[model samples]
Target: MRFSVNKSEKYTVLVPEEEKLDSLKAPQLKAEIVTMFQSGTENLIIDLSSVKYVDSSGLSSILVANRLSTEVNGKLVLAGLNEHVMKLIKISKLESVLELHPTVQEAIEAIFLHEIEKDIEGEED
Candidate 1:
């Protein structure tokens, strides 16, 4: 899949430039996410603004990302999902599990907020 990775202080934003996230590109995406996690990236935000379609394989890849992030006490968030993608996630009953935001900025903010909360809890501990 054609994509770009932007790294910031506490999170990484992956923007896929493909129109459809299908079996052909999902494996590559999943591999990349694994690599990022292994490299110490924890918080992840996937920007789906350019994606119009996502198949079951794509959803599986996303779930993999979420699992990887959670394994490290981080977060995986999705943003800018179009109607079709949103419908697919809802139909799959993943809406309650996956974090969704209307924009990348919102997702980033949420990530930072959660991080701060975690830090506060750690201090208490």
Candidate 2:
């Protein structure tokens, strides 16, 4: 799946226009997410609204992005998951580890809010 990037609130959004996200495209997606992570961004968001299908490998790609974000004290978020895909995440129990927003705008807002909350906590110390 090919994607475009839009940086917002120190976050990079991977907007993929692919119809499916499966094993075949998982590696490429993983690499793209890693590239964003390595670009010194504070957060990342994979906008999956246009993605209609996801297999285990696709899920693995998301995990890879999550791990990369964590390693850098950044965030990896998801947005606009269809019900079918949402069910998959629920079944996999990945929802707890990953934050999901109803829309890309919300995802950006969430990342910004998360950063603010972190700053507030640090200041309170």
Candidate 3:
């Protein structure tokens, strides 16, 4: 539940400070993501560099964020995942479903690129 949030015009970066993202913290994380979406945050970047462990509930929270982002035609990005967490996501077969980046900066760039793509598609329409 302990985290830092950096808000920008286009996206928000949420960095959970916990080492373990398990059932105990997953609910809070889900609630936070929902609240951000309700508050009109279309794009989100979750920086998981500090987290070394995660459970199914933790992955569920991330999935919730992705669903919300899709609902708003936005982007959900994960960054700085450690090896263990990455393996867990891959094992869950979520690597193909989610956007993963090596750093927050790269994630931000991806979001911007996604926005540009959307804009181009809109213009084409």
Candidate 4:
């Protein structure tokens, strides 16, 4: 998979435009996801605006990314999912595990808002 990262004061955005079509190196993709997490970004927003089709292996990679992000108390939000990709996520039952936003702006706001809510919850506790 290829990605470009942009960091604002609030969060880091990873825009993954293309993914490996084959199932090989799925583990490697997972490793890369972990690397992105360790890249010192707090909240993460993954823009899937350019992604076309995501297979089972790709879904696995995304799950790993989500897990890594949550481990570090960060948000992993997906934006601009195409119809086919959305179907794949729905069929895989991954929609429940991941957050979906219609636009990049919405995803960014949701991620930051989620973090703020988490912080508030932590403070309350």
Candidate 5:
């Protein structure tokens, strides 16, 4: 539940200060994501560099974030995933479904690029 939320015009970055993202912290994470999305904050970057373990509940929370982003025409990016957490995501078959980045900077840049592409597409329309 302990996390930091950094919001800007482009995106919001959530850095959870927990080593294990399990059932105990999943609900809080989901709630925050939903709240942000409902408040019209779309693009999100979840930096999980500090998390060494994750469970099904954690994965469910992530899925919620992704779904909310999709519904809001936004993007939910996961960054700084360690080896074990990455394996968990892959095993859950979310490796292809979710946006994954090696670093927070890359994730932010990716979101920016996507927004640019969307803006271009909008202009064409």
Candidate 6:
């Protein structure tokens, strides 16, 4: 459950320090994601560079974050996933459901692009 959070006006980056993301840590991560959304953080990037492993619960937590972001018309981007983690997500057929980025910077850029698209769509209305 140990993580670091860096917040900006546009989005927040959450980096879990744990090497393994399992049932024991998933709930805490879920809670943190919920808290951030409740506090008006719409866009989020989860940097998983340090995490080498993930279980079903961990994937569930990530799904919850994606659901919350979708509910608010925001974006949830997962970044820095290692090969093992990426393989698991692909195996689960979640690679299409989740936004994956190779780097946090790329994820941040994506969030910005999403915001721009939203802005454009709003202007059309």
Q: What would you estimate as the lDDT of candidate 5?
A: 0.93
lDDT tens digits, residues 1-125, model 6?
A: 79999999999999999999999999999999999999998999999999999999999999999999999999999999999999999999999999999999999999999999999999999
- True-structure lDDT of candidate 1: 0.97
lDDT string for model 5 (1-125, tens) is: 79999999989999999999999999999898889998888899999999999999999999999999888888999999999999998888889999999999999998999899889999999
Kindly list the per-residue Cα lDDT of model 1 for residues 8-116, writing each as its tens digit. 9899999999999999999999999999999999999999999999999999999999999999999999999999999999999999999999999999999999899
Q: Which stretches of candidate 4 lie over 4 Å from their true place?
A: 19-29
- Residue-pair clashes per candidate, as listed? 0, 0, 0, 0, 0, 0
Off by over 4 Å in 5: none
Least well predicted 10-residue stretch by lDDT in candidate 6: 63-72
Cα displacement (angstroms), candidate 1, residue 95, comes to 0.9
Which has the greatest lDDT?
A: 3
Cα lDDT computed for each candidate against the true fold:
0.97, 0.87, 0.98, 0.79, 0.93, 0.97
Compared with the true structure, what per-residue lDDT tens digits does model 2 show for residues 1-125?
68888876578888888978998998898888877777787688899999988999999999998899888878888999998889999999988999999998898888888799889998999
TM-score, every prediction:
0.98, 0.93, 0.99, 0.86, 0.97, 0.99
lDDT, candidate 3, equals: 0.98
Tens-digit per-residue lDDT, 1-125, candidate 3:
79999999999999999999999999999999999999999999999999999999999999999999999999999999999999999999999999999999999999999999999999999
Q: After best superposition, candidate 1 residue 17: deviation in angstroms?
A: 0.5
* Candidate 4 pairs with clashing backbones: none
